[model samples]
Target: MKESLYKRIARELAQQISTGTYPPGSLFPTEMELCEIWQVSRHTMREALRELTEQGLISRRKGAGTRVCEPPTSGVNHPLSHLEDLLLLAKNNLRVIKKIDEIVADIELSQLIDCPPGSRWLHIASIREDAQNPDAPICWTDSYASTDYARLRTFIRDDPHSLISDLIETHYGIKSHEVHQTITAVGVPKKIAKILNVEPDSPGMRIVRRYRDRDGKVFETTISIHPAGRYTCSIVLKSQNSGE
Candidate 1:
């Protein structure tokens, strides 16, 4: 699911703390200033600040401004938020294709992918694994792309980490301008439970993503699943006014 606005703000702030943008013992920007900077209501800003305090990263005073108490003890983990981090991860992880087949999007698939019903898409299944230890699986992903991109699937056989967007960019001169993702907790389905090595209905994470070009046209969609205890996504929130 999309993170709550306050939670997203909190994560940004936490990230700044972890990165030393707002060093320990420093006073954070005022709540009103933060509200204006982030374009959020005061209530929302307070909630975000409250989260920082509860996490032991900040301290709140009645009259004085909020202060950074300490840096985060642990660094956030993958799936990463920054492009640099993603490229780094791709270098350390490998994508292995399992299946690639054409499928007409039904009502359910249409809703899940934000695509038109009856549209043709190539459904591709793959597993991303740690390069050093192939047995250590990162996650199982089901990717969808327009049938126009089907020929790329043939090329993927040779280059396992070949991404659909890259192929589209390479062959068709189209580039993904934006990528949106939603992460949520869910129960492992029977179909993929065996692949994930988790019991049916076991706790898992569902990450849905859509890739769009400059014209705001979506050309790719992906749904990735991972067992909860085995994988996690990390995030850091920053205060808007400080630009930390």
Candidate 2:
């Protein structure tokens, strides 16, 4: 789809502002001048200018025209690029093993992890804490790995890079090439809240990730809980409908 006149004007102005064409603390063109320059109606000009105002690039006043402000801070924001990025981030945290169990995937479990009902698997309970401060918990993860790789228990305790998918590739040569993730916000559960050191019923982020190999077989699934403000996930999306 083609860009709208207002969006095109807004983007052009934003680019100019970012490039210092319209320097900070400088006065912007009057509404009438902008309308004449863009050959657009007053409504279109006002809408385009509104975009810059909302983005904190320009301010409007009764006496003073729109004045440019300093650009917003660009730090403290990160995106989850892909499985590799997520796996790399795991190395920065410490996973303390809680216990391991063998279980049958009942109806609830099958639906939760998209696994075959009644199938047996290994359930590993662990808490990931910030390496900088062990007392500051990051998340509690309940992981299910294919029972065939149960022998990995020996290395999981001592290995610094002990992500289940990483262990599978190391031990079985089945490299995971993709990850499917789902995030939800919910009230903290009793078991997870205790592990994360937060009060019961506190707001939390529940993340479920399935690691799959080249053939799309999900060999590892992890359900993790992070207390409010402890962990965050970010994503950057491209405009799919744009004629790129």
Q: What is the C-alpha lDDT of each candidate?
A: 0.74, 0.76
Model 1 stretches with alpha carbons more than 4 Å out: 1-76
Q: Single out the weakest 10-residue window by summed lDDT for candidate 2.
A: 72-81
**Candidate 2 segments exceeding 4 Å error:** 1-78, 240-244
RMSD value for candidate 2: 12.1
Q: Please state the error at residue 131 of candidate 2 in Å.
A: 2.5
TM-score of 2: 0.66
Question: Native-vs-model 1 lDDT?
Answer: 0.74
TM-score of each: 0.64, 0.66
Q: On residues 27-104, what C-alpha lDDT tens digit does candidate 2 reach at each position?
A: 999999999988999999998887667556689998977898874343111135445445434655678889998989
Q: Over the stretch 103-193, how does candidate 1's per-residue lDDT look in tens digits?
A: 9999999999998899889899988875434554667899998888768777667666646567677777777777888888999888878
How displaced is residue 190 in candidate 2, in Å?
0.4
Best by lDDT: 2
